[model samples]
Target: MLFNIFISDLDIGIKCTLMKFADDTKLSEAVDTTEGRATLQEDLDSLEEWANKNLLKFNKTSSSSVERDLEVLVDNKLHVSEQCTAVARKANRMLGCIKDTTSRAKVITPLYSVLVRPHLESCV
Candidate 1:
């Protein structure tokens, strides 16, 4: 598409990796050192410049310390405990609902697989 062609060279001369999917563009780099942080900032500046040159705009507010993708929450530090906890809580609630609805042991296994297992599996 024309949009893809226009931004295809957006990663040129950049040290970090650029992941472009649909309307989302993500820039990723390890920021373990001061130099690494500077490199990330430089990449951000380059992206802003590219947007300005192409007459495109970025939604600044969407840039956050934590981002959710594929039902997984990832923070800037790459911590996923919050995601695990959230998924666990959701699955627990589903289990509780199943418990309240049926006393049949055989039915619970099928219900759990259909209703609760996906959350546990996906978050891991």
Candidate 2:
């Protein structure tokens, strides 16, 4: 059986929260500023140390990679360019729904309702 792990320090205001479902585990932190990024890095280092102490091996290669220097929107408002890329202009199929480029039209099928709707609705 897999044991759950929880680590929180109220005195230092450090909470390394994680959500686990079956074999999937996710860790998230808001790093909008330099200090926040440093804290998150420190927390990750501590987590690595704890895992080593417990003899729990982690897959470092499984971590996702983000493309650097890409412009991201904030608060749903465009900050950089108004033009959309070709990939962004095409329809995206997610959770059984075909979301249009403009997001003005959505195509949903019966399969979506039976399989994808529940998973999408349960997302936090």
Candidate 3:
């Protein structure tokens, strides 16, 4: 609540869509044309100015080719295969780690339920 109050004016001068969740802020606009790209850039500049004025710093390492909205990976075509594959890969990694750490017969069920199930359930 205090953080929200401090940053409530973040969208005051932004023209594009501004999504704020916890500490993450995203500027979204369709960049199908030169004008749209220019507008998005202008909004980005404004955001930077705002951050500077407010003494805030943004995470520089959080960018990704696949955009995530509300914790779901999304692409232009809105296909689920990428999300499914990512989840499966993560779950497999966790399973491998669990296999190395303990005997499967002893802790597989509990470990899978605690660590791996959420990744499998993330898609669809």
Candidate 4:
């Protein structure tokens, strides 16, 4: 997640790691620390940066499953997908007779201001 932290915090940490790896053309020291993983994923997830960097990938055949946040996984895979969709579909059908706007944006804005907008701005 993007955070509005001082750029020095990110830039120095990032520049140090890049220089460390670049100094040794053979990559004698591998980055396997927690901080290293965070820096690597940040670079990989960045559109402009990742395209300019070398990619690292795993073979599908060599992949193994780890617990994933069901709502965030790509295309909704995992056993939870099946259960969530089934429940949601049934709930939607159950709501077929409803005609209401009581749960609309007008009623939700005050609550959302405290919950969502500030987080969005900070992240961006």
**Most TM-score-accurate candidate:** 1
**7-111 per-residue lDDT for model 3 (tens digits):** 999999888999998867879999999999999999999998998999998777765557766777877576667788889999999999999999857688899
Q: In candidate 1, what are the lDDT values of residues 54-104, reduced to their tens digit? A: 898999866687788766798888899889989999999999999999999
User: Ranking by TM-score, best first?
Assistant: 1, 3, 2, 4
Candidate 2: which pairs clash? Answer: none
lDDT of candidate 2 at residue 37, scale 0 to 100: 84
The residue-by-residue lDDT of candidate 2 on 42-117, one tens digit each, is: 8777767766876776687743333212333222232223222322332234432443323433434654565555
Estimate TM-scores for all models: 0.74, 0.42, 0.60, 0.19
Tell me, by lDDT, which candidate is best.
Answer: 1
Query: RMSDs, each prediction?
Result: 2.8, 10.2, 6.1, 15.1
Name the regions of candidate 3 deviating beyond 4 angstroms. 64-68, 74-80, 86-124
For all candidates, the clash counts are 0, 0, 0, 0
Worst 10 residues of 3 by lDDT: 62-71
Please tell me which model should have the higher TM-score, number 1 or number 4.
1
